[model samples]
Target: MEAALTGSLLSLSNNLDTQAKAAQKDSQALRNISYGILASDKPSDFRESLDNVKSGLEYTTQYNQQFIDTLKEIEKNENVDLSKEIDKVKAANNRINESLRLVNQLSNALKNGSSGTAEATKLLDQLSKLDSSLSSFRDYVKKDLNSSLVSISQRIMDELNKGQTALSNVQSKLNTIDQVINSGQAILKNGKTRIDRLQTVLPSIEQQYISAVKNAQANFPKVKSDVAKAANFVRNDLPQLEQRLTNATASVNKNLPTLLNGYDQAVGLLNKNQPQAKKALSDLADFAQNKLPDVEKDLKKANKIFKKLDKDDAVDKLIDTLKNDLKKQAGIIANPINKKTVDVFPVKDYGSGMTPFYTALSVWVGALLMVSLLTVDNKHKSLESVLTTRQVFLGKAGFFIMLGMLQALIVSVGDLLILKAGVESPVLFVLITIFCSIIFNSIVYTCVSLLGNPGKAIAIVLLVLQIAGGGGTFPIQTTPQFFQNISPYLPFTYAIDSLRETVGGIVPEILITKLIILTLFGIGFFVVGLILKPVTDPLMKRVSEKVDQSNVTE
Candidate 1:
C-alpha cells in the first residue's frame, strides 16, 4: 500500500511538470502574439492583431484553468495546504480577465478613431497592478511550487511587463495623433473663413480693375496723339520757323540801309532836276515818306512775332488752339499761319534749300556703306610683314577714299540727270561732293580701324549727332545748345556750306576756305587712324576670342 501511494504521488508530480512545460510554451507563444499586435502600424493590422490577441488570451485562459484543475486534484489526494495557492491562482485569473476587458475597450476606442486617454490610463493602472500581482505570484511559486512551475510564472510576469510597455507606447502615439488632428481642424476653419471673405469682395475688386483698364484705354490714344504732335512741332516745325525768321531778319538788316541810300539819291536827283518833273518828284517824295515808314513798322511787327513764337507759353497756347482746330477739321486741314508772305526772287524755280543737306547725307551714307562692307586688312598677310598697322590703315583708307569719290560722282551726276538740280557751278558741285565724301570716308574708316566693332558703333553715334547738329536742314542755332556748340566741329557743317555755295553761286574765297577746312578734317582722321590702330587691334583680337569661346560653350 505504501509503494502504490508513492507511485501515485510521483505520477502526479510528473504530470504537473509536463503541464508546466506546456503552459510555458503557450505563454511564450502568447507573448510573441502580443508583441506582434503592439508592433502593428496600420488600421487593418491593428484589427487583425486584436483578433489574434483575443485568440491568444483564450488559449492562455484554458492553460490557466487546466493548471488549476491539476492543482485541485493534488489538493484532494495529497491533503496538502493548497487553499492559499488556489486563491492566488483565482486572483491571477481575475487580473488577466480585467486586463482582457481593458484591452477590448482600448481596441474599440482605436477602431472609432478616439485617443482613449481615460481608458488607456485605466488600462495602464490595471496592467501595473497585474504586473505587481504576477511578480508576487512568481515569488510565491518559487517558494511553494516546484522549479518548473516557478520558471513558468516568471516568464508570464516578464510577458505581462512587455505588454504593459507596448500599451504605454501605443497610448503616447495616439495622443500625438489626436493633437495633430485638432491643429489641422483649426487650420482648415481659418482657411475657410479667409476664402469666404475673399469671395465676398472679389466682384468689387474685379470691377474696379476693369474700370481702371477702361479709363486707360479710352484716354491713352488721345494723350499719345497729343504727345506726338508736340514732338513733331518741337523737332521739325519750330526749328524750321526759327531758321526762317533768322534768315529773314538777316536779309532785312543787310538790305534796308542800301534801299534807304538809293531812295535818298533818287530824291536828290529829282530835287536837282525839278521844274520839268514837279509832279513826279512830288509823287516820289510822298512815296518815300509813306511807304518807307510803313515798311519799317511792318519789320518791327515781324520781329515781335518771331520773338513771341520762341516763348514757351506762346508755343503752348498755339499748340492747344491748333489741336482744337485739328479736332474740328478732323485732321484734314493744314496748320494755320498767322501771316502770309510773297517771294520776290530774281530767278523763277530756284532749287530747294534742302538740296545741299540731301547731297551731304547721300555722301555720308555712301561712306557708311564702304566701312561696313569692306574689311580693313588683308587676312592672308601676317602683321609682322612689310605692311605696318599704319600702312594697313592708309591702304584701306585709300581704297574707301576712291570708292567714296566714285559714289559722290555717281550721286552728284545722278541729281543733275534725274532731278535737274539747279546748280550754279556744276564743276564746283562735283569737286565739293568729292571732298565731302573723302572727309566722311576718312572719319568712318579711322573710327573702325582704331576701335574695331566698338569703333563702328562710335561712327554710328557720330552720324546721329551730325544729323542733329550739322545745321543741314535747320539752322544750328535753333537746335539744343549742345548741338549748336558741337556744330562747328561736325564735318557735315563744312560739307553742306561748301555744297550750298556751289549750288547757289560760289564765291571763290569762301569756297576755298571751306575746302581747306574739309581737307583738315580728312587729315585729322587719317592721323588718328595711323596713330591709334596698333594699340587697339590686339586688344580687340583678345576680346573676339573670348566672345567666340563663350558662344561655343553656350
Candidate 2:
C-alpha cells in the first residue's frame, strides 16, 4: 500500500517544474504585451497591440485551463478544495476582449477619415484599460498560480517522503509475518507426523470392533426376549396410564381461571402505565443529547474550584500565602516571591537614609572649593623671603584643613538639627564628618601644593568619580563593574559608609573600621603634603614663573 501511494505521489509531483516554467513564460508574455499597449502612441501601433492582447488573452485562457485541470485531478484524488483561482483570469480575458473591440472601433474610425485629437485621446484611453487588465492578469499568473503550483508540488513531495517511511515500516511488518508463517509451517509438520501415527493404529482398532460385534451377536437371543417383554408392556399397559394423565390435565384446566383471576387484573394495571415509562425514557434521551454537556462542564469546573480549596491543608496554604488577610491575597499572588527584606539599621525616611551620601558629598565639595578658590602655598615673594617654605606650607595647609573641618561640622550638625535626619549617634556622625573632611581637604591641598593647578583638577575629577562610584546614592555593586571594583579605594566610599553607620544607627566595630580607614587616608595625604612640598615647590615655582610669562594664572 505504501509503495503504491509513493508511486502515485511521485507521478503527481512529476512535471511540476515544467508546469512552473510554462506559467512563468505566460506571465512574462502577458506583462510584455501590457507594456507594449501602454507605450503605444500611434493608431497603427495601438492596432498591433490590441491584436497582441487578444492573442495573449487566448493564451491565458488555455494556460488557466491546464492548471484548472490539474487542480481538478488533485481534488478528485485528495481531500482538497480546488479554489476558484481561474475567476481572475476569466475576468481579465473578458476585459481584454472588450478593449480589443474598442481599439478596433477607434482604428476603423481613424482609417475612414475620422482622424483628430479626440479620436487619438479615445485610442489612448482604450489602450490604458487594456494595459491595466493585462497587468492584473500577469500578477495572477506569475505570483498566485505559480505559488499555488509550487505549494501543491511541495505537498506531493512531502507525502511521497512520508510514504517512503511507511514503506520501510511495512517491510519490517512483512518480515514479522514471514516468521509467523514459518512457525505455522513447523506446527503443521508436527501435526502431520501425529496423523501418520494414528493411521498406523487404525487396523488394530478395526479388529477390536469386529470382535466386539461377534460378542454382541452371541447375546442377541437374550436381548430379543427382553425386547419382546418390553413391547408387550407398551402395547397393553401404556395406553391406560396415558389416558389417566390426560384426564387429570383436563380437570386442572377447568379450575385455572379461578385461581389466576387477581394476576390478570394486576397485569392489566401494569400495561396501562407503559406510556409514562416511555415518556421518562424520552426525557432522559433528550437530556443526554442536549443538556448533559453543560452539566458535565459545570461539574468539572466545580471540581477544579474544589481542588484549590479542598480541605484544611489547602486552607492552611491560602492563609499562609495571604498572611491571614484576604484583602492582601491578590497582591501576594501578583508578587509571589515572599522576600523578607531586613535592613539592620533602618532609617525613618528616604531623606534620613540619603543624609549620609549627601553629607559626605557636601564635605568633599567643600574641600574641592577651598583648594580651587584658596591658595595652598602662599607664593608672595616678600612672604617667601621672610618665612621659610615649611612655615608657608604649614600655614596655608592648616588654614585649608580648618575651613574643611568647619564645612564638615556645619553639614553634619545641620543634618541633625535642621533636617532632623535619623542620626542614631549624633556625636559619631559629627566626628566622622569632621574627620572625613580633614582627609578630603588634605588630599586636595597636597595635590595642588605638589602638582599646582593640575592637583585642583584632580580634586574635581575625584568628586565626579566618588559621586558615581561611592556606595552613596546607590549601592556600589549596582553601579558599573568599574565603580564596584574601585569603590573600596575611593575616599568617599569609606566616608559615606562611616556616615551611614552613624545616621542609620552605629555598628560600633564597623563604624570604627570605617573611621580608621578615613584616618589612615588623612594621615597618608598629610604626610605627603608636608614631605612632597619642599621637593615640588621650587620646581613648580620656576614652571609657574614661565606660566606667569604666558599670563594665564594657575
Candidate 3:
C-alpha cells in the first residue's frame, strides 16, 4: 500500500509537470494566432473607413434633399426625383457599418486567445458573408448611385442657372461618395480573403491545442484510480495489517507454556523407554557375539563424550557468550535504519513562510479596494464631447492604478520594515509586489471600467479562488483537484511563488518565468481595457440605468 501510494503520487506529479510544458507550447500557438489576427488592424482602421463613408453618405443625402427642394421651386410643370437612389446609398452605408461591427466582434474574440477558437471561427464565417454583401453594396453605390447623382448634376448645370450651386454641390458630393465606396471596396476585398482563410487557420490552431492537452497525460489516467485505492488502504485497511502483527506476538506468548510442556513429556517418555532399549540390545548381543563387541565399543565412546562434557564447562560458557551478544544488539534486530533531513533553503519560521501569501493578499486587496471606491469611468460630463471612451477609461484608470500601487508599496514595504519577515532579496520582493499591484489594478479596474458593477464581482471571485489555490500557505497539489487545476491560472499563484523565492532564495529561471507570466496577464488585461471600453459603452449605460433605478446602489 505504501509503495502503491508513493508511486501514484509520483505519477500525478510527473504528469502535471508534463501537462504544464504542453500547455506552455499551446500558449505559444495561441499567442502567434492572436498577434496575426490583431495585427491586421481590421477593426480600428476599418472603423475609420466606415466613419468616413458614413459621414460622406449623410452629407450626400442632405445636399440631394436641398437639390430636390430647389427643383420643386422652379419646375412646376415637371417632377424630378432621386430619393430612391439616395435611400439605396444610405442603406448601403448602414450595411457597411454592420460589417464594421462584425469585424469588431472578431477582433474582440481574438483577444480571448486560444480559449475562444469557436467564437472567433463563428464570427469569421459571419464576416465572410457580410464582406461579400458589402462588395455588392459598394458596386451598387459606385455604378448606380454615382451615375444618378451625376445625371442630376449635369441637368442642373445645363438647364437651370439658378440651380448651378446645387449642381456643384451634387458633383462634389458624388466625387466624395465614389471615393468612400472605393475605400469600402478595398476593405471588403481584404476582409473577405482573410475571413475565408481564418476558417482553415482555426482548425490547425485547435488541433495543436488538443494535441498539447492529450500528449502530456501519459500516466495520469492510469494512476489516478490507484491513488484512491492506496489512500483507502492506508485509511481503512492499514489497521488490519497492524492487528496481524499484534496477533502474531500474542499467539507466540499464548502457546509458549503448552509447547514447553510437550517438550517435557517427550523427554520423560524417552527416559522411561531407555532401560527397555538397553535390555533389548543385551538380548540382541546374546544372539550375536559381534553385536556384543559393537555395544562394548559404543559404551566406551559414550564414556569419552561424558568425560569431554566435564572438561571446564566449555559448552555452557559458549552459550553464555551468544546470549551476551544478543543483549548488546537486540535494538538493531528489531529496527535497523537511520534517516537524516536537510532543508537547503530553510525558512526562519512559519510566519516567515506565510509572508509571501499575506503580501500577495495585501496587494490584491489594495487593488480591489481602489476599484470599488473610485469609479473607473471619469463620468466627465464636460469632457464628454472632448474625449473618447477609451481616453476616459485610461485617464481614470491611471488614478486608480496609482492608488493601488501605493497600496502595494505600503504593504510590501511594511512586511519587510515592520513585520521583519525573512527575505533574501528585498528589492526584488518590493518590485514584484508593485508589479502584482499594477496587474491586479489593471484587471480589477478594467473589469469595473468595462462591466461596471459586474467587473468588481469578477475581481472578488478571483480573490476568493486565488486565496484557496494560490499555493501560499499549503502546497497546491495537496489541495482538492479543482483548486489544483485552477492553481496555475490564479493571478496570485506566480506572485506568491516569486515572493517565496525572494523570501528563501531566488532561482533566476523561476523568477524570470513568473515575471513573464505575470506581466503577460497584466498587459493582456490592460490592452483589453483600452480596446473594449468603446465596445462596452452601451452595456455600461444600460447597467448604469438599472443601478440608478435601484436607489440602493451608490
* Clashing residue pairs in candidate 3 (N, C-alpha, C atoms within 3 angstroms): none
Backbone clash total, candidate 1 = 0
lDDT by residue for model 1 over 469-513, one digit each (tens)? 989878888999999999888888888988888777767898788
The window of 10 residues in a row where model 2 has the poorest summed lDDT is: 197-206
Evaluated against the true structure, the overall lDDT of model 2 is 0.69
Question: Which residue pairs does candidate 1 place in steric collision?
Answer: none
Task: Count the clashes in each prediction.
Answer: 0, 0, 0
Task: Put down candidate 2 lDDT per residue, 133-225, tens digits, no spaces.
Answer: 666656565666655555554554454445444344434544454354447687576556534432442233334334444545655575566
Off by over 4 Å in 1: 1-351, 382-384, 552-554
Name the candidate that leads on TM-score.
3
Q: Which lDDT tens digits does candidate 3 get at residues 6-39?
A: 3332333243233323323332333344344445
Q: Give the TM-score of candidate 3.
A: 0.42
lDDT of 3 at 150: 50
The lDDT, on a scale of 0 to 1, for candidate 3 is 0.66
